[model samples]
Target: MSEIWFRTGEATVFASEGQATDAMPEVVIGSVKGPVGTAFASMLGQTVGHTRMFILRDCNQQVRPAAIMTSKATITNSAYVGLLGGVVQAALADAIVDAVANGVIPKDIVNDIAMIVTVWLDPRTAKDENLDQKELYKNNYEAMTTALTRAMNQEPTIDELIANRKTIRHYSLEGLDIE
Candidate 1:
């Protein structure tokens, strides 16, 4: 089966394969159900080979679908099973979109997602509270490369540059032309 690593809080839709019908019936969030366990059985029923789904739970008052994992048999020519997994994943992602759009899921889930993205993009900040106490800095790959190139200016002497240099964590655009 195809391995779909979906964004958090997103759901996908899946349809049956090779039914040879006009209207393909779609099942949304077949991986995880609101009432719980219903989606599990449905996914198992849909699996042509082997599949596994994961449900992340918060002790009380919160039990939602977190992640889904599906596997295909090694000895079987089950390439179509990958297509099936993709369908299911898409349905799950759509379900997430619908839930968020309809406000079925709490508003904080959006904020949680944003926070997660922020943490991933800025791991240095996320690592420690004190880390942000210094002058806050965010450097992208291009920006960092530009800064390095500028730092290595055509100096008269390496010793002179070394003597004048300061060990600074942050980058500045002011000193690039100084030779």
Candidate 2:
């Protein structure tokens, strides 16, 4: 006769070698005619050595899939800085493209303006710790106004505009977080 093992909860079931099913007491219940009964009956003939089956009865029961944890590789400072540079460049390019497309800036000087802006606002440069979007936009607007005025009065090189760019800083009347 085939051996049968029953388990419940988190308990372990131990069975002796060459165990017979006749040693266990018969368990009888009313006919189970639902999907669960069908699945259980189908599983009885297919179970092999040390097979495990879970039957969840409670509607509130939750089963979480097991996960294997792995260690992530370390990144060097130079590599991290490189990634930041790429991100900054992409953001600057996108902003320049949007500005030109929206007619905020002239299309003819977009590349030159982009270059000057990139040099002036390098991500590697030190910035105020508390600077936020409003402060950054304000500073940029001020810088652009100054550059445009200079260009209108007298033609200044890109280097001059870069040198005349405004510094970004946080300024608020009431104490509050910007983000």
| Backbone clash count for every predicted candidate, in the order shown | 12, 0
Segments in model 2 whose C-alpha atoms lie over 4 Å from true places: 1-76, 111-114, 118-179
Q: Which parts of model 1 are misplaced by more than 4 Å?
A: 1-48, 53-65, 69-76, 109-179
Model 1 clashes, total count? 12
| lDDT of candidate 2 over 19-134, digit per residue (tens) | 21011111111112433233345544422321212211123321111001110112234433332233322333333344346554455532221111211232322232432433
Tens-place lDDT digits, model 1, residues 94-165: 433444455644434432221010000222222333432212211221222222122223222468657767
What local distance difference test score does each model get?
0.29, 0.28
Per-residue lDDT, model 1, residue 35, is 25
RMSD to native, candidate 2: 33.7
For candidate 2, list the clashing residue pairs, or say none: none
